[model samples]
Target: MFKKGLLTGVLLFGLFFGAGNLIFPPNIGVLSGDYFIYAISGFIVSAVGLATFTLIVSLFTGKGYQELMSDLIHPKFALVYLVALYLTIGPLFAIPRTATTSFSIGIEPVLANEYKGIGLSVFAIIYFAFTYWLAVSPTKLLDRIGKVLTPLFAGMIVLIIILGLQQLPHSPMNVASIDYSGAGKAFGSGVLEGYNTLDALAAVAFSVVAMDTLKTFEFKTQKDYKRTILFAGVSVASLFSVLYVGLALLGNYFKLPDTFKGNVGTYILSEMTQRVFGPSAQVFLAVMVIVTCLTTTVGLVVSISKFFNTIYTKFTYITYVRLFCLLGFMISNFGLDTIISLAVPVLLVLYPITIVIALLVCLHQLVTLSKVGIRLTMGIVTILSFLQVLSTINGFHYFKTVISLIPYHDIGVPWLLPAVVGVALAIILPYQKITKFKNNAEEKK
Candidate 1:
């Protein structure tokens, strides 16, 4: 159990630690500056804390997200939610962004200016080819990503971190990228920044892999299952904390120029590494980014494809994988900026609901809430999410103003109060189990 648990934890870490994970912390460090301690504390709450909560909640249900969420929410809603979730994490945004980021930070800097476009094109093809090769076999995934790739990436990352620490300046510049005038505001900003990691959502989605790995290890007893999963979550969380803090400190130590500001996590790390380790840092970071991105991209492809094939049966898992990889490869050429721009609206809509649902899942036994209540709560979240997204557009300044009036809306989550109200209303309303129509597939199982 110990050995298997460690491997599963490492695998989970690999899946969760992608380009976004690598980029966010250091930027937070740069932004928070003197308030680093307060900021990182809040960052960990939403990043590591919520993600750990997600894993624990999924373990309780002992089922994939589809089954668990479907049982709680309507099956139709679950299907739509899942489809959007997978696409956001897969070809549509995360996967492609990984390639683009790797190219921009790791490869583009070293390439001649004339060859930037060609360099990105060639790199994307090679990157996705490797991803496709590794992801083609689902069972072999653990062998490749967990056993081999993750360890390699970890070792390299450790070396970079060690080198960065060795060369750390005696003092940080203590510059504030943003006005973190108070601990409360700094913490709130940190929490919002940490949302870019998307670790919580990945934890929920990857619950399928975690459960499957446990089954493969032949842990049948419920007690053993819980123990092993707890170990894995702790292991992943510990490692994430170490990496996040280390990277953030590295960013502070450097005090990079204003030219590198605005989504400069990759630049800070890359430049710091090069400064510490010389030209070799470029090669090392490039390799690390590619391997890290590939592991995550492959994991996304496998999980999404497997889920789709299981539910729809319109295509085989491999077929879905190929299609996703193809799509990811095409979109990757759009570059990191474009992908990030696209992701904002989708994430704004999805992240709050995900957080609320995961929280409800965790508190399921303690709360006397019906499915209707939960649905209503999520409905409020969805409406607010839509409003939030709309507020991002040029013509919706009024909506943004109104949303800003909500408590914590300034912190980026305007839907919290409405969701709470929905929950309160549910608890007060008459208790009733609204009978849901189960599909033929669900009936067979």
Candidate 2:
């Protein structure tokens, strides 16, 4: 039981604490300054809310997130969700960011000034090479690296927190214009920033891995499985809350240079290392960043490969892994900034839809609706979400001038109102008898 719990903690932390996680809170802290508490609260709502929803989905369905969603909705909806999830988590966005960010923070500083780009290219080549290698091999190496790196990351983070606190008195007061504004804006921005971490999405992906881990322990009874999952969930939530809070506070206290714009994780680590450790701090930080990033890249590769293999049994794992890694590497060459800019609009659309589905799954018993009702609600949500995403990308003004005025401009259109309306419609809509029978049976007990 103890080992099982520890494994759960390890897996959850490994999934949650990726390179983006390291960067976001500190950036929020620096921007938020005195408003740090409110900002962190909002960030926690998205991060922890997603995590909690993921745990609930894993426990009740006893299937992978994709499988559960597909069962609840149509198979076509499941395919769209899976493709969006992959693009969100893999080659198009998150995976490439992993390689690029790691190189920027981990390798660039140590090289001769002229050689930095060349150095980055070389390191990225090697990093993804190893990513591809382990991805194809499918061994214990990925897990071993995760076990080693997660503890080191936790320790390094703790050290950073302590150093920042020690230097707080000497740091200047909050001077940014954004910080002068009310806490609500700061908090809302922070929440949006935290969404960039995509840990919540990763949590859903990793739950299948966690379930497999439980099965290996011979958790024969339903009670044992539930206890194990709950234990794991608590462990992950506790660790994430502590670390996220600590990092945000660290960022809040430090008065950094104006040059430290964008790439928050890299900026914080570089600045803090310089202050705390002097010139040599750069080299130390670079090494730590590389290792942490590499561990994440490898784990993602392995997990994604495993997922694809399950879905596409005919294709060899090696073939799929290599193809995906190569695609990820090609995409990484485009650099981090571009990927992030493109991802935001898409994530804005997809996150609400995913959350709605997960929430419905969790409240399935209370829903007491036919499958047709559920499908109709889901369809409505998806359509509205796509419209919002399009409007965001095409510019809000264009949308306003061309399309009918959406009611909720303050919180953005196609969000809470559409979702609520969909739910109400589902409740009120009539459905065929066959669809109602199974849904009623499942909800009753």
Candidate 3:
């Protein structure tokens, strides 16, 4: 039982970590400057905290994200929600991000200025082509990404930080990056950046994979089944916290000169690795990025394609894989900065909606929540998220003004107070829906 539990934990770690997740911590670390402590704290809360909560929702409920969400909300709504979720984390954003991030951090530093554009173009095509092959083919090599490469990649970050601190002169922490000078702003920025990782949202969509894998094992009892899953969830959270904090801490040590190039987060790790381990680390980083990102990209494409195929069997898995890889290839050439800039706002909107659902779902499991509360809370969240998006646009001061009326609106999550009211109304109102848990009695079997 113990061995199986630990093994499940290890497996979960691999599934959770990816090249796409590796960038944010160090970047937040760099940008938050002197306020890094507060920044990292907020980051871990949203990134690690919410993702762990998501897994628990899956385990305790005994329904994968889709099953549980479909029961609570409407199936059609869950389907639409999932489609947006998958695309944002799949071909349109994350799949392409894996390529651009790998190239910018791992490969671009070695290329001459004249060749960088062509270099990125060539790298993206080759990256997605390999992703397409791996998604459809499915190899033992892909398994190594989770079991082997993930550990090595994580260890490399730890090793670089330890070695660099000992060998390299530390740059004194100075002014915070543009908007991060204030502690509140830094922490809020960190929270928003945490949304960028998409781990929390992915946790729900990817819960199917984890729960399915757990089901394959024979546990002596229901307790054992739950224990094994808890082991997996806790282990992944621990690993993520250690890596994210370490990466963020290391970010403070890099001296950003006027000549510093590329994305801040990507550059910190790449530059730090180069300084600590020298030119050889560059080759290793590039190869690791390509291999790991390829595996990550393929996994995303496969998951996304499979879900779409499941919904509409008219398209074969291979066809969807090819389509997405082609899309990812075309989009990745827009570069890392462009990909991130567009993706963050979309994430900001999606994350809170998911978080509210996860929160209400967890709360409901403890004690039944009324449909009114659930519906009201979700409704307020959706409207607030829309306003949050509009408020960020060029000609939307009124949207900003409406959101400003909400307390704590300045700290990035303008939805909190309204969401609280919606939850409060649920408790006050007596409209109980007697919602059934899709897996309550039958899950253990």
Rank order by TM-score, top first? 1, 3, 2
Q: What digit string (tens of lDDT, one per residue) describes model 3 on residues 1-445? A: 6666566565555556666567788777778878888888889888889988887787777776666667666566678788899999888888888889889878898999999999999988888877776678643323555567666766766677687667544653546877677889888888888888878877775666666566767988889888777777778788889888877777776676667776777777777777766859898778656655665676677778878888899999899989999999899999888988899888988898889888877877776667667777888898899899999899999998898898877678899888888877765677755356544345345
Q: List runs of model 3 lying over 4 Å from the truth.
A: 137-142, 168-172, 259-261, 438-445
Residues 227-332, candidate 1, lDDT per residue (tens digit)? Answer: 8888898899998899888888877677677565446788887887787778588888888888887888888888888888998898988899899999998999
| Residue clash pairs of candidate 2 | none
Tally clashing residue pairs in candidate 3: 0
Off by over 4 Å in 1: 261-263, 366-368, 425-428, 434-445
Question: In order, what lDDT does every prediction score?
Answer: 0.81, 0.69, 0.77
Q: Give the lDDT ranking, best first.
A: 1, 3, 2
Q: Cα RMSDs of all predictions?
A: 2.5, 3.7, 3.3
1-445, model 2: which lDDT tens digit per residue?
6557667666667656677877777777777767777778878877776865676576556777676676577657877787778667877788888888887776666778899767767777787888886556544642665467677777776786777678776342555346325576666666667677787777666676666666667776777767777777777777778888877776777777666556766777777778887877877777667666666676667767777787778987787778777877788777677778888877776777777777666655455555666776777677766666666554566654432465543233345666677666656666641231143346567
TM-score of 1: 0.93
Candidate 1 lDDT trough over 10 residues, lowest sum:
432-441
Give residue 420's error in model 3 in angstroms: 2.4
* lDDT preference between candidates 1 and 3, better one: 1
Error of 3 at 116 (Å): 2.6
> Residue 237 in candidate 2 has what lDDT?
76
